[model samples]
Target: MRQRNKPWADDFLRENTHLVIPSPSEHRGKWQELFGNNNPIHVEVGTGKGQFIVGMARQYPDINFIGIELSKSVIVTAAEKVQDSDQKNILLIQENAENLNEIFMENEVSTIYLNFSDPWPKKRHAKRRLTFHTFLKRYETALSPKGELIFKTDNRGLFEYSLVSFSEYGMLLNEVSLDLHKDHDPENIMTEYEEKFSAKGQPIYRCKAVFRGE
Candidate 1:
């Protein structure tokens, strides 16, 4: 889906620099310092409108959350949501997921979330998928030795592809659910997309995988 251009996006980003961090790479490996605590850090790669991250921050006050989104117009809405939530543990980054290595160092992140990412349903565009080997490599470098990669999507094809990709990349699947909503996980935090899709009776697929270090 094409994002509608927001003419005030640039100004909004400038004014809310505290919420939407600028030059996030400079904080690599020192994210805990930014949060002013030793709490574990979690990142959401495709934080669409800040629902999941903000909700997670509210649920786990001890953990720090960073939301990475590429769209300036889209992230501005997320930034506004974060601002309204007034959660100090949450931050936003206007950047691409491909630069995860540059924004975080080895063993820096504890958990990474890929929620309702674009399926990129084409053989030629498979490399662009969030679960692609290249992105998995980046996640391995940034996540701690025991760090986890949790993924949720309504697209079965992407879920199957991700399970295969994770196995091929030597990642251990700790948990998987083909029908997450049916399982009734009380701790589950729903993203905007998740709520919208699950409301339509679509099965939500989820998995928690950990990288097997060398």
Candidate 2:
């Protein structure tokens, strides 16, 4: 679903300057300095509306969270949530995920999250998928030695595709779940899409992969 451009969103983002980081690449290797601690950094790609990242920040104050979203119209809503809340460990960046390696230094990130990413279901569009080999290679370059990528989605086709992709990429997979909500997880933080789809009895698929750096 394409998001309708909200002209006011740009204004909202401008007003909440502190909630989002400026010149994210400048602080690539110094991300901990931005948070004033050496805590592990966790980032979410395509963090729509920022519910999950904000919730995670609130729950785990010891870890730093960065939300990478490309759309100003979409990330503005996330910035507003950070502005209204007491979350100091979170910083939102309006940047493309393709430039993640340049935005953050190699082995600097501890974990990466891909929540309900665009499926790009067409066969010709396979390379556009977040879990595609090209993107996986980029992630491999940016992730720490033992860094892990956790992904969640309601799309079964995408989920299956991701499993095959990860395995072929030589990543170690764990905690595979085809029906996430069916098993009550106290530690689970629901994204906006997760809540919407789960309400309609949709089962969420989840998996975690560790890049072997092979």
The number of the candidate with the highest lDDT is: 1
Summing lDDT over every window of 10 consecutive residues in candidate 2, give the lowest-scoring window: 9-18
Top TM-score model: 1
Instruction: Kindly list the per-residue Cα lDDT of model 2 for residues 1-214, writing each as its tens digit.
Output: 7888998976776777677776788988999898889999999999989999999999999999999999888898888888777789999999999989889998888899999999999999999899999999888888898999999999999999999999998999967998988878789999999999999999999999998875
Question: What TM-score, to 2 decimals, does candidate 2 have?
Answer: 0.96
Residue pairs with clashing backbones, model 2: none
lDDT of 2 at 58: 94
* Distance from true location, Cα of 90 in model 1, Å: 0.3
Off by over 4 Å in 2: none
**TM-scores of all candidate predictions against the true structure:** 0.99, 0.96
lDDT of each: 0.96, 0.91
How would you encode candidate 1's per-residue C-alpha lDDT over 1-214 as one tens digit per residue? 8999999999999998899999999999898998899999999999999999999999999999999999998899999999999999999999999999999999999999999999999999999999999999999999999999999999999999999999999899999999998999999999999999999999999999999897
